[model samples]
Target: MGKATGFLEYERQGGVLVQEKQRIKNYNEFHEYLSEEEQQIQASRCMNCGVPFCQFGMEIMGMASGCPLHNLIPEWNDLIYKGNWELAYNRLKKTNSFPEFTSRVCPALCEAACTCGLNGDSVSVRENEHAIIEKAYKEGFAKVNIPNIKTGKKIAIIGSGPAGLAAADQLNQRGHSVTVFERDDRPGGLLMYGIPNMKLEKDIIYRKIDIMKEEGVEFKLSQNIGKDKKASEILKEFDSVILACGAKNPRDIKAAGRDAKGIYFAVDFLTSSTKALLKVRQKDKKTDNLAKADGFIDSKGKKVIVIGGGDTGNDCVATCIRHGAKSVTQLEMMPKAPEKRAQDNPWPQWPKVCKTDYGQEEAKAVFGSDPRVYQTTVKEFIKNEKGELKAVKCVNLEFSKDEKTGKNLMKEVAGSEKILDCDLLLIAAGFLGSEEYVAKAFGVELDEKTNVSTQKGRYATNVKKVFTAGDMHRGQSLVVWAILEGRECARQVDEYLMGYTNLSPQ
Candidate 1:
């Protein structure tokens, strides 16, 4: 703790953003970093609770209630408060390998479980993290930590996402030679493609990867193990293999006209858009595979309907708006949450409520109306003569608990069916599990949901010398969880490879 009266003296202050109107014009990061003085003021607000539930990382009511990485939140907050940024950066790096990525994109579970949040606001832990890590970069403190001795063990990590990266970082620190294989053209799997550039700039990812490269981690891009590259070769070559392939198989909508040409998976759309942006930046004149001017699905001058109102759906809305669509609408099956926390929702758990995300704000600003349609769903698709999706047939729903089963379900109101004119339809229904090719190729067992089946707390697969982590084992989750899984999984791999390990979870 920096000062006993620090919490009382300062209130929480989050990072600011660029104007919504200006930010929507291009695919770039919009968040403005807090000034050094402002970051210190926010850091001083940490109460440094005795219990410190923020780092507990427990499962409360079947949901993650705190930082899964169990980050040293209070220590870093105190460090920031005292203007000891290098120390704060060191503490952050002890557990998390990529604070810059998490600081920008993570949901900040630590703040939700903050002790100060019991009565009032929580400390800006996420913003303070962003400040510390960026400060490290500026002050030349962030660099490659080359191990003094080599263990002569070799490890292969399948997938270059957060989990794989973290595992590589720790395992390499143990003096084992590690190589990461990614099917995509670049490293940073989902971070490089699945997420939009505006949320996380690609250069930031490349910068860290450059350092990792210098630290002796080899990255092989466009190498699809078990497909283009043989799993047998990998198994024969490396002493151990860790599968960190993220959950990429998207959950799709299977309604009438689902095979129509205009419909697309949210991941596909986002991935294509990012690829287009990267191509443009690379100045590759090859427009052969670029997303059309009408948007990923040609939303320009056409009505766009997005299904499933999560972060992916919001991204579609923002992307369409930027593409100059005539109109954009989103559908949500669940009822709209309240604006504030309800009486039943006590402190230290995620606030169950409605909050306008950045995309929605941009939509509202441009369209002069909130584009979300809660308690509604697309029943079917209406197609044109060319077999392209022209509109979506939707129905209003009433959410209520069933008397017989006592389960919440949606009931369609009579004569509530309506057709909304649309040209592009995006299904943002989330992901089921990791892709089947690599897992099946490696002969790894899977859970009922198709996730890599390893007992919780143990990341080892059935095959000896094989390990798994991130969405490959846990399904879709936050980046912080991926980092945690990666770090912990690295420890497990180190122990298996050398019969001993020194990687600390804390």
Candidate 2:
């Protein structure tokens, strides 16, 4: 809770974002923070409501309403309001293992469900968290905590993603020797590459990884389990194993010329961009010179089309803009959401409203119009004689609810098809599930959605002494949920290993 009258007296203030026009020139984090005093005032706006829904992580109307990690928003906000910077950081770290990652990338579910938002602007809980975490790093409070007593138990985590890293951190703190195996050369699965550098710099991830290493968590890079290393070997080496490899099998666009050379998955494009950017940074090359990089899918001076209207698609738009795209267009299957909250979509539930992400903003700033075209999808990918992508045949669609099952059905609008010139096509249509090879290698069962199958409300799989969590277990989800799953899974593994656990699941 915050000051009794603070909500009425203060207004919420957010971190200042660099103008899109200037930020698109390079791939770097563009958010500028507020001073300590200003952030405290914003934190003071957290009302002392009897029912603090901001911390109540729950699913309502088939969508997440609040912070899935159940972060101690009120406690941290109160501490920040009182200028107890260190204590605020402590309280924040108690629940959220990595506030730095979430503060920069998370959509701020806590703010959306804040009680203050009922009548006025929500409390700047996300900004307060950012301030606390950054201050913790600056003041050296974010130090490594090597466990005093090392348990004989050893855990082999199969991924270095948020879930895997969180599980490793918790289990390591509980004195279990933890080793995280990553297929990629670098750690931080999605954080490392899938997300672009502008949203989250690579150095931020490496900074936390260094601290984890100091805390006694081992990271084995370039170790692709089930391929390079057998799963049986890991099971024999470690007392227990947890699979946190994220859902990475991207869903493909079904259209003619799908095999065109210029088409790429959104993750692949983003990964390449980040990898090239990091390489250039290491060589002291100009940051904006990613087009000259050898490995990346260069979008400079090329007409680009991105399919899918989600966060990843927006990221592709922004990345293409940063690459100095000749033109950019985004297609969405669903109709455009209302600008503001709908009457049926009440507070305390995830608001189903239109969100103009940073990438879309940058596209508009550069192109003089929003790149998104709602109710549209690619009907065909037209390739030239050279077998490279040349254009896309797109069509508008309409949706209607069925009478019996109450399910929405989509139908193409007659005579709405149109052709647009496109040199590059990026499909950000989301993922199907975890890759099959990993599941088969581990001898784990998969559900209909291709996610690792488990009993209802359980992290344990069919295999004995083996567990799964995060997107690999629950399908595609947020980083916060992945961390929460990892923490909870670590607790389960700890109990199974030691017959009891003192670790907190929350």
Candidate 3:
């Protein structure tokens, strides 16, 4: 470490954020990075613990703790502390294929179980990581690394999200002739659309896609493998196929009047907004909030009601605010989590706590209050004469444990019903599983949860020479887990193709 006592000497500094009012006006990322020297100081705060729990990927109490990619946290932190930006990037890339994307979108699981965070604030590992990767991109160290030898083995990957992209990067670098099929007009499926641009700008995704193209990965856009092209045809062409389509079957509300107009899935709304922005930016190069809302449903001047209190719900709140919504509200069926970790949640386990994310912050800033209401849910939708959403009837929820079964049962509180005016109702209640179309097209079996069936603890599917990774197999999860699944799945695919492979597991 650059300074042995740096953790004690310096206070933890996270990425600075743009003022909420100002940031809500634009769809750009709000967090600003610290300077080089300040970032070095933040990196120096890494304790370099003998255990280095930050890099320890482990499942505790049904939730993953620490970095799933098992990044070389201590090594990279030391490099950053010493001002060796290139070396830090090198160490980071040893495990992760795309740091730039993860730096922006990931929830910083590494920081939660950090040794420094046991009592005090955690080392700013996430921001330090951003600084490292951004420096790499700016200083020209992140150039295209074309594979020296061509394996001449052809591989087809379906989907172009983080998992698919990571697998393509690894396999292509190993000299495999990899072709990625994306159903969207562009690559980076959810990264391009599901996630709001303010969280992860579209250009950052295109930049990485550009690099992948230069390194010999062919990206076929607007091709739905099972629909536009036949899965059987791809199976005949490629030696092996990997499916990385994310769990995108959104969980929709079935309350009365659900079919009313002015309601949409969170992903659909986000996708439409991004598509409009892309269309406008490409045509006129304007960054202002002006875009064609022809087919896409908009929330401008509409009372918006969002169901679900997760990150996606928060994103909806922020997006609605930016769209000039008259008012906004988010509904959570469950009781609010504790502000601090409970006694049962000890160190090294994922903490269940209340943390206001950027979207919630933006919502609070714009509407003069937080949009989230704990222990509440939409009971039914109210509609107008034209069958459009006019408002929603909500009811307060009370959870009680069963005396004998020990199961938490939800009970609707009597006389606790209220109706809120709403026109745009966006369901942000997470996903069920991968859409059945692609999995069914490949003749692969699905698990009870409707995810692609894979061998226990493995990525191989029921069909021979076919594999599934990411949310498509693992259910809805964070981006970092998708990257890990992709890397490990690629290694297994390489082994299957080359008899014995040289690809490193993440």
Candidate 4:
């Protein structure tokens, strides 16, 4: 759809990244976008291949190969390459509801599966998407679109994360009155608090939320559906209830002296950090001066140890560095991945290679080395006389394959215990599943994995007019997957309410 030989003629160039040395000084979006002309050149590199796997949206070897939302990559790339910004945004929005969020935070599965990436650099699809969405907002193409017809049906979405927001957007557009309930003060659940502000600025979330409010979608923030408002009341009021609260019940570290005062869950830490920043910004209209905010977990001049080596751990490392930490260390139970893709992990399959995310990059730039310590786990949390964290006892781990099961098993290595000074410990061990209270409150059954259960390949619950989607239904996953499930769930709900739906069949 782009230039026939553009892939051969042009090289891949991405958005300008602010130097870590300077960007780490504050919490802000650090990537500077390219000009429209430059983005058009990048878009022109789209091969328009016979099999455009960039939008395949399927599983390969149990790993996601492309955009789960099935974005029309080629058509939008062609439109952008022709300098048709409005049409590019139109095509882009046909599939994705929140391009701004995904363009910034998504791992870019599209590029991973691009045909050009098989031989060389892939098209900068994510950057192109970012450019298109930002331009749409600038040119007023993304203004509020209030529904003209009212179907008189009401929907209650019991969360404000990507999934809940997607469903609310879709259902509201379909002429159903939608009210989104969020326990947090802000509307974007994980996106608003769980994710660090530097990765996704709060203003960006607010921008879209304001548009939704103008478009007739109601947001009841600081309202916990089960506690603040009863489930029975919501059921009686709304025609359909969608539980998209997400899997946020954190898996805690079960180590000796686990009750240390300075240890906290990763989500709590991130939420507090973002809240502190926002409080400071709101008071002074500035991003800095966070020291004045209350309830902030101060890591200044403290030795910090983070448990788990995923994105949350990396975010903790960067947040600690920004807090003026004395030193930082990250513990991971699993062994480090290979620097490059393994033979078993080929192209079009999600690569199992190591990635240095933005947070890790900032940590290295400040600390002179990567903070991750693979094949290691904390054995005990050493506490002081006041029951505050003072140090951590760690042990090395080793893995061996079992001949019968053909599965790898982990064991603690003998005589490898070490004690490191740690004033603060953050557990980023991930989530178990959706919190049981919400499910129990609504009489929703849970699967073995603790996710809200449903019939195979369906969003309907045992209760009539009650559906579920996103992490609550499928366990923890990416934002793109959440949006896809939300859209699908909305279609199901529309059909149930009106006995038919015109929404996309995604």
Candidate 5:
């Protein structure tokens, strides 16, 4: 720790953001970085507990309690507090390949499990991390680390998302030749498309990819293994293949008129929006087929209905507001959570409660009302004469314990059907699993939930030289988990390829 009495001297100071009214007018990041002095003070707040549960990465009640990548939180926080930013950045890079992405989007499990949080506020670990890495980049401290010797082993990483990228980073550091294949036009998979540009700027991803390229990692874009190129062919050329394809199979709504026009998956909408933004940025005059599809589903002058209440749903609301939507509403099947932690939830656990995210704040600023509706679900779609969705029929629900199963079950309230006028509908109902095409082609077994089946510790599949990581192996999760799985999976692949490995998790 920087100062013995730092926690007592300084209270927690979170990162500041632009006002909602000003931020909603454009699709750009509005979060302001804390000054260097302020960041140092925040770093000083780390009490550096004896056990340091913030870096333990244990599973409490099936949910991750700390940094899954096992970041050296105390060491880095102490480093930052002492004005040793370069050392802190190096410590962060030891485990995570992409701190910029996680710093921006991750939910910050470390703060939730902080020992200081038991009595007072937790340290601003995430913000301190963001400051350290960003400063390293600006001061030319972050550079490509090229291995001195080559192992003569070749590895193919399928999907260029966080998991694949982390695996490639580790394996390449071990002197293994690594090539990543992505079906999309660019690398970074979901980071490039699924997430909105406002949350994570595409240039940040490209900058990291450029450094990785300089480090001798090859990225093949628009190459679909098992489709454009055969999976068997890749297996023959490379000594080992790792499938890092993320969970892309969206969980769809199957109500009446589900196939009607104007209704789309949240991923599809977000992807289109990002593509449009990219095209505009590059000044591409040639219109693509998607660009020709009534011009990218702009919410301008339209009433929007989002069919979920998770982060993705909230993102949809924010995007719609930016596009100048007339109105916006988000539906949640589960009842609203309590405003504060419940009695069952104790110290050192992730608190489950209701909180307004950035998107809801934007919606409230523009429309003068909160956009979420709790304990509600869409039952059917009302279509116009042209077979386009015009509105959604929905109903309220009540939750009660079932006598037989002793589980909470939802019961729709009788005579509670209602219709809301809507011109655009976005289904943000989450993902099922990784896409089936590559898994099926490789003959990989899948769990009941459609995730690739593999033992937790042993990430290898039934196939001898095949491995899996990220959402492909563990299903939808945080970027931090993806990075951890990727790093561990790369160590496994290294040992399998050479019969020994020196890649360190420390």
Candidate 6:
């Protein structure tokens, strides 16, 4: 440990953000990087316990408790505290290929299981992580990693999200020619579109992609493997294929008037808004009619109703508020978690506490209150004469134990139905599984949950010379988990190609 009494002396200093009033004006990253001194103090707060639960990476109470990537949290934090920038970055990259992505997007599962959090606030593990990677970039240590030799082998990776990108980075470093195919015009997959610009700027992703390209990874954009290009052709061309297409089959809200216009999936809405936002920026166009453009949905001067109270729903709330929506509301099926961790939620398990996120914070600031309506759901959709969504029929829910199964069930209150004005309805209810075409095209089997099937604890699919990873195999998960899956999958692919392999394991 850098300082024995560091945890006692220093309070957690989280990353600061731009004021809501200022940040709401534009779609750009708002989190202000902490200074070197402050970051050091945060890093020094790590207890560096005998067993660092922060990096334990185990399932506790059916939820992720530690860093899924098994990040070397204490090592890097100590390095940061001691000002060993290069060593800290090296240790970080050894376990994670994309700290930049995880630093911004990962829920910081490490922080939740921190030893410090057992009694006091968690050490600023996530913010310190963000600091290390950003500082590495500033110090020019984030350079291209070119292979010293060529293996004369080729790998084709489907989907250019975090998983595919990590696999490509690893395999390319192992002297294999790696090629990533992306269905969208941009290559970062969900990282480029599904997530908003304010949280993770697109340019950061582009810069990383550019570095990968320079390091000999070939990116094929707008190339849908199952449709635009034949899977048979890809199989014939490469020695191996890794599918990381992600779980994109969005769950629908099957309520009354569900087919009404102005109804969109959360990903679709986010993707369209981002695409339009960038297009306007690139064209240097000056207009407030962003949503008025064809195929774009704007929330300006409208009452926006978002279903499902997860990160996606919160993102929708923030986006709508930025769009100048007259008012915004979010509906969650489950009751709100307590302000503090419940007794059942012991240490090392994900707290499941009611913590306000950036989006909710912004919504609270702008709308004068939190927009989340807990234990609520949309019962039906109210449509106008033109078949456009105008309002949502909502109802309150109560959790009760089933008499037969002893399981908790959501029982709708008999007289709690109410109608709320809604100009646009975005389904943020999460995803079911991966889309069907690619799996069917490649003849890969899917599990009961609709995810690509692989042997228990393995990344290789039943199909010969094919593999699956990330959300495609594990269902929807954190960015850190995706990176872990990709890295492990690459190792498996490498071992299959050569009789053995030399890849790092977390």
Tell me each candidate's TM-score.
Answer: 0.96, 0.99, 0.98, 0.99, 0.97, 0.97
How many angstroms is residue 232 displaced in model 4 relative to the true structure, after the best TM-score fit? 0.9
Candidate 2 per-residue C-alpha lDDT over 1-506 given as tens digits, one digit per residue, 9 for 90 to 100: 66888998977777789999999989988999999999988888887568888888998989888898888888888999899999999888889988999998888999899988887899888888999999999998898888999998999999999999999999999999999999999999999988898989888999999999999999999999999999989989999999999999999988888988899999999999888898888877555687557978899999999999999999999999999899999999999999888999999888789999999999989999999999999989999999999999999999999999999999999999999999999999999999989889889999999999988878898999999999999999888999999999999999999999999768
TM-score of 1: 0.96
The alpha-carbon root-mean-square deviation between model 5 and the true structure, to one decimal in Å, is 2.3
lDDT of 3: 0.90
- The per-prediction tally of clashing pairs is 2, 0, 0, 0, 0, 0
Better structure of 3 and 4 per lDDT: 4
lDDT of 4: 0.92
Q: On residues 19-42, what C-alpha lDDT tens digit does candidate 6 reach at each position?
A: 998889888888887899989998
- How far is 469's C-alpha from truth in model 1 (Å)? 0.5
lDDT of 1 at 67: 84
Choose 4 or 6, whichever is better by lDDT: 4
Give residue 145's lDDT in candidate 5 (0 to 100). 78
lDDT of each: 0.87, 0.91, 0.90, 0.92, 0.89, 0.90
Q: For model 1, what is the C-alpha lDDT against the true structure?
A: 0.87
lDDT of 4 by residue, 211-293 (tens): 99999999998998788889999999989999999999999989899998999999999999999999999988755667889
The deviation in Å at residue 366 for candidate 1 is: 0.4
Candidate 4's C-alpha runs over 4 A off are none
- What is the alpha-carbon lDDT of model 2 when measured against the actual structure? 0.91
The clash number for model 3 is 0
Displacement of residue 2 (Cα, Å) in model 5 is 1.8
Q: Report RMSD for candidate 6.
A: 1.5
Query: TM-score: which is higher, 1 or 2?
Result: 2
